[model samples]
Target: MIYLDSAATSLQKPPAVARACSYAISHYASPGRGGHKPAMDAAAAAFACREAAARLFQVPKPEQVVFTNNATHGLNIAIKALVRPGGTVVISGYEHNAVTRPLHAIPDVTVRVAAGQLFRPEETVEAFRKALTPEVTAAVFTHVSNVFGMILPIQELARLCRERGVPFILDASQSAGCLPVHLEELGAAFIAMPGHKGLYGPQGTGLLLCGQTPPPLLEGGTGSESIRQEMPDFLPDRLEAGTHNIAGVAGLLEGLRFVEKQGVQSIGSHERALTVQMGEALAQLPGVEVFRSKDPSQQAGVLSFRVSGMDCEELGEALGRRDIALRSGLHCAPLAHRTAGTLETGTVRASVSAFNVPQEIPRFVRELRQILSEKP
Candidate 1:
């Protein structure tokens, strides 16, 4: 099958990632839970993963990076801890439901929409200038909108938030590994990323780098402080609770290593080249409306579009029948779809990964063209 939905989750992982998980299973033990040999070994391996993540994200300390179930979990933890009762949270119009739903669920948040494409750095900075008011306690922005491959100006926006003394939480679910994320340069207060997406790890793995030590969301045993009833005041320990996802973290560590060896810049360039090729092909096809930046360099490895007179779901299935995998509908970012003016029927999402190449693009384009021309 020609898999084009890496944005949802990367299917094929590196061999080392699988090996790491296998090693963890065979050596089965709880990390940081006990003084046993297996426990120590497991804990050491877990810390190695944390260190690799720190290096990749440019986080100052490995302890600040906490492993979570997924990007949604990390986002919820950051939002719940950062959003105050009387304060406002600034979010872009093109935000995933993960950010919007939780904020809407909160009684005190004031949502604002700005007319700026995420790929336009100046527009993103201006969006913050309009949204970051005195009452705004924190701002949540997606590093890359899931619906479209719009790469937001995170560093510029984060600078504005830093000046205003408002925490900036970046949901890097779509751009974490596909694009460069320098946590230090961005000065982001919190960064939420799924290991399964760009990192090419297991589905259950995710990372939450508490850049500025956000408040605790989950309170429970961290296996470090046995005497404390309340959550520890430490960074990751304060937020991390219960038994850790050791195997998942192990796999994620291997994925990070793979990314480092492959070089993030090269992977990014490769994915963008593929996405641009597909975008051009789709644009030339009759009745296809491509939703992405005109400049390929401004976008990530995502392509969103819809063919006229065809249902998004049916089109997706048609492509699938030809062994071409694609995602359809909202892509968990209804606000992005709404902002891009593609919300009604949603759009077909083709998210390319580092594994995809130029050869796969033509097959996908050919099938898509056939699907669009065929009768329902």
Candidate 2:
């Protein structure tokens, strides 16, 4: 099967990731649970993963990194901690439900959407500037759109938030291991990402890097403050509740190692080249509308498009029959579809990964053209 949906979850993980998980399952115990050798070894492995993540993201301290189930979980914790009651919260139009749903749950908080023109960075910045009034208590945005791969001007937005004294929260779910994310340079209040995407880890692992200590989302045994009912005041322990996902962390450690060794810039260049090829080919196809940047360098590895006579779901089914894996429909970002004027008919998303080859691109295009030419 040709897998092209890396944006959903990286199906092609490094061999070391699986190996580490297998080893941890047999030999390791719960971290910080006991002083036994097994537990101690597990604790060390978990801490090493934290340190590796810190170094990769340019985080100032290792302890500030908190592990969670996925990017959605991390975003919930960050949004809950940063957003003030009865205040305005600014966000981009391309945010997933992970960012929008949490804000919806908060009472009396007004959400202002800064919807820029699709693939236009200058318009996005202007929209953000207009929405970031003094009443806005915090700003949350995605570094790259999951639906269109539109790269937002995060550095400029960060600078604007800094000048306005608004806490900036970034959702790096799509851009974490695929692009260069310097936490120190961005100066965001909280950065949330999943290990399963570009990091090439298992699906259950994620990270949230905090600039300041936020209130705990879940309170339970952190193994540090057993005597007290209240959660610990420290970083990871404060947010981390219950037993650690030792096997998941072990796999994530290996994944981070792979990313570091490969280098983000090199990986990004390779992915962008694939994106350019796919986008250009799709645009040239008769009756195909590709939703992405005219300049492919400004985009990531995602390409969303639709055929003139075919429903997105029908096209996806046809591709699936051919053993081609890709995503179709709204892609969990309706606001993005609305911005791109594709709300009525969602686009077919073909996302590439490092494991994908240039040979697959032409085959995919050929098959897609055949599918589109068929009578409904």
Which candidate comes out best when scored by TM-score?
Answer: 2
- Candidate 1's TM-score reads 0.97
Encode model 2's per-residue lDDT on 1-376: one tens digit a residue: 8899999999999999999999999999999999999999999999999999999999999998899999999999999998967878999989999999999999999999998888898888999888889888999999999998888899999999999999989999999888988888999999999999999999899999999899999999998979998999999999999998899999999999999999998888888999998988888888998887878778999989998878999889899999899999999998888888899999999998878889889888888878777756
Tell me the tens digit of each residue's lDDT in model 1 across 125-216: 88789888888888899888788888887777888899998888899998888788888888887899999988988889899988767677
Candidate 2 Cα errors over 4 Å, as ranges: none
